[model samples]
Target: MKYALGPILYYWPKKQVEEFYQLAKASNADVIYMGETVCSKRRMLRNGQWLDLAKEVAQTGKQVVLSTMALIESPSELRNMQALVDNGDFIVEANDFSAIDLAKQAKVPFVCGPSVNIYNGSALKLLVKQGMQRWVMPVELGRDWLIRLLDECSNLGIREQFEVEVFAFGHLPLAYSARCFTAQSEGRTKDECETCCIKYPQGRPIVSQEQQRLFRLNGIQTLSNDCYDLINDQASMGGLVDVLRLSPIGIDTIEHLEAFRQQNDKDRPFPTPDTVNGYWHKLAGIRQSEDEA
Candidate 1:
C-alpha cells in the first residue's frame, strides 16, 4: 500500500506551513493532502496562497488533494470549497456535505475526508455515483467494520471504482464543534479572539485530574491525546486498503513518514513507534489490547 500525508490540523505560521509542505514534497508519502481542514479563522495562508502551493506541490509528481474545512460556518467557506473543487489542477477532499455538492456539480472526482461520515456499502456506492474516487475510513471504525464494509462493496460490485484509505498515524481527530475551545480556554470570544491557536502550533492538551492527557484542543476540533502508530500492521491491509494517511502533528513529521515507508518497504521490522493502536483492535478508543492483559 502507498502512504498519504493528511492536512495540517493545527494553526501555524505561514512560513512554517510552507516549509512543512516543502519537506512533504521530498518525503515518501505517495499522496499529499493540502489546504485547511480545521478552523478557517486561522488563515495563515489564504485561498489563493493554498491553490498556489497546490500547483507547486503537484509538479513534484506527488498527487495533491486540497482539503475543505470540516465545519463550514459561512458563505465564504462554501465559496472556498467551490474554488478548490474547480481549480482543475488538483483534486479536492470533500470534508462536508456542501463540498460534496460542489464537487458533484463540478463533475470532478473528489476524495471524502474521514470527517465526512461515509459508513456502509450503500453510502459508499452513492458517493461513488457522486464522483467520489477515494474515501478515508472514519477514525473510530475498526478493522472488522471496515472488512464488512468492503465485503458489502464487493457484493455491490463497485469495489474497484474507489480506493480505501485509513488514518494510520498521528493523533486521531475525534470531533469538532461550533464553539472554539481554545478561545474559550483563553477567555476570549470566537469572533474577537486574537487567533490564540497560532500561538499553539500543536494545540493545547487537556489533561485529567490525575494529569493524564485526555484530549488535544485545536480551535474547535477535539483530537486524541496520543499519536497513533500502525506501521507494524501493514500486512493486514493487503486487500483492504490502498493508501495509508499519516496526519501531521507538530514535530518530526518527515521522520515518521520515512519510518512508515521503511516499514512498508521491508520485512525486517522497524523500531516500534510509541503510540497507541487500541482503536484498531476494537477495544475502547484509548485502551490497547495489552492494556487489558
Candidate 2:
C-alpha cells in the first residue's frame, strides 16, 4: 500500500522545520502531514508555514494534510482549526470534534486523526456523512479490534467510502490534557512555562528510578515510553489498510521512511524499535515481551 508521513509532534525551530520538509519532499512518502499537533505555544512554524510547505511539497506530486491540535484550549485554537478547514487547498486531519464540525461546515473532505474516538461502524458512518475521506486507526487498538470494526462497517454497507490508515511507526500518542506535563516537570506552571518544550525536539523522556523509560513528556501530550513499531506487521494490513503512516522522529527519519517504503523487499532491513511494539498483538502497550516480535 501507500505510505504517509504523519505530522511532526515535536516542536523544532522554524529553520529546522523548513529543512525537514525539504527532506520530506525528496523522500518516499506519498502523503505528508504537517502542523503543530502538540503544544500551540511551540509555534515555531505556524499554520501559514504549514500551508506554504504543503503547497511546496504538493507540487512534487505528493499529497499534504494539515493536522489540528488534539486539545483545543482557547478561542484562538478554534479559530486556527476553522482556518485550516477553510484553507480550501490542502486536506485537513481533524484531531478533535470541533475541527470535524468546521470541515463539515466547509464541505471539505477531511481525515479523522487517530486521536479522535472512532471506535465503531456507527461513528464511522456519521463521519463519512461529514465528508471524511480517510480514517486513521487508533494507536491503542489491535488488529482483532480493527477486523471487527471493519466488519461492522462492511455490514453497514459503507466500508468503501474511506481509506484506512494505520500508525505504523513512532511513539504512540497515548493522551492529551490541558496541563502541560513538560512544564510541570520543569516546575513551571502552564501559563508561566515559557514554552519549555521547545528545548525538547522529540520530547523529554520520563525515565523510572531504575533508568528505564516510563513515558515521554511533551506539553500536555503523554507518549509511549518506547517507540511503537509495526513495520513487520505490514503483511497483516494487506487488503485492510490503504496507507501506512510513519510519525516523524529522530534525525534519521527519512532513512526509516525509505526502509518502510521498501518493506516488500525480502532483503530490505527494518529499523529496530527503540524499545518494543505496542498493542497490535493485543499485549501491554509498553510490555517489552521477549517472546513477541
Candidate 2 lDDT, tens digit per residue, 1-293?
99999998987788887888899989988999988887778877777777888999999999899999898989998988888888889889999999998899889999999999889999999999999999999999888899999999999999999999999888889999899999999999999999998888778998889988878998899998788777767777777899989888865787888877677555444656455665888888886444575
Clash pairs (backbone) in predicted model 2:
none
Task: Name the regions of candidate 2 deviating beyond 4 angstroms.
Answer: 209-211, 267-273, 288-290
How does each model score on lDDT?
0.87, 0.86
Instruction: Give per-residue CA lDDT, model 1, range 1-293, as digits (tens).
Output: 88899999989889899999988888777999999888778788988999999888888899999999999999887887788888888888999888998899889889999999888999899999999999999999878899998999999999999999999988899999999999998999999878998877778888999999989889999988887878877877889999999888854887888888777767775565457778878887776545677
Clashing pairs for model 1 are none
Best by lDDT: 1
